[model samples]
Target: MTGKPKLYYFDGRGKMESIRWLFAAAGIEFEEEFLETREQYEKLLQDGDLLFQQVPMVEIDGMKMVQSRAILSYIAGKHNLYGKDLKERALIDMYVEGTTDLMTLIIMYPFSSAEDKEKKRAVIIQKATNRYFPVYEKILKDHGQDFLVGNQFSWADVHLLEAILMVEEKKSDVLSEFPHLQAFKARISNIPTVKTFLEPGSQRKPVPDDKYVKTVKRVLQMSF
Candidate 1:
């Protein structure tokens, strides 16, 4: 990858947001082609760029990469963010997988009906506080490490930080009860590269609003 990697996705944060987070963590600059219209998305499909017919296709290392996990793994490996050994990588994978489950809920929250939005919000908070946050809190407490695995920064930390912020967007006080996680969030957010990404005018996307929802639905030809 001589030049910056180019990412293909919508203007909002879908599955591609984590990819952006990983790139930021790696201190790698990239370009983006936001698919704002049905024609644009159809053109990508017509060109056969999307092997899985998905928008998160990334152009990196002389290849067009599809599938969010595969793209993330490649970037992580290239940047030495995966792990030192197979055991450490396994631990990172486990942590990343857990965070992915939490992220999936947040990603789909915008698509809920007006009536179901409140209910869904409550569900997300419940899972974050009770199911997810506690697990990470314990991991940090037991390991006494700044990161989730091998006492070093890895893909798991990047994904977890992203997940924490996304949950916080839903509920401001979501992390008040988890002291370890609160510290971890503060530490990760202050990483020079991540701090820059958090600033305004950066590539970080805001929460999905009506326009974002409408654009994504139209581009993907979704009914609900």
Candidate 2:
């Protein structure tokens, strides 16, 4: 909390991307140490930096944090993005959990085989438009608020916007059927902090390409 939070992960948008989005939404600047080779990841393991032998470890407030959810909850709570009370926090958690589910699908898409990519893409788009987006759409509509939980900009909004963009990367017109989500995307994208992150030079990573996939697989010793 004194200096910027330093993030450890591969150079692409994996589990760490949501952490980046939360920091951006909270208007906090952070640094990232991208793991491009197996040695780099193994060094973290050797140093006991990774709690569960994973990346997405963050150095913040004198603690080395791993586990995406734990890191996200801390950032959100510290930055007042979690919620006002337990009830509100519960709602935020519900919305964010759903968004995380959708994001998991998109995150793994690039790792699929060539033949499976199309099938994966279809599933992603289908879930986004039908299962996921509709839920947020209804939430925004029923609440008649600018955000998903309590009508305030919180972690759920940040995660939802991030998930929306990820889905759109697979299908440009993915939000066409979800009018409220379209508006939500526009609204959240323009927040001063988020806007800066969306600009060309910010730390926001792009959708994973072949090189990103290969590097992650190599560094993590993953087959898929």
Question: Model 2, which residues run further than 4 Å from truth?
Answer: none
Cα lDDT, all candidates: 0.94, 0.91
Backbone clashes, each candidate: 0, 0
Looking at model 2, report the run of 10 residues with the lowest lDDT sum: 1-10
- As a TM-score, model 2 comes out at 0.97
lDDT of 1 by residue, 1-224 (tens): 45999999999899999999999999999999999899999999999999988879999988999999999999999999999999999988999999999999999999999999999999999999999999999999998989998888899999999999999999999999999999999999999999999999999999999999999999999999
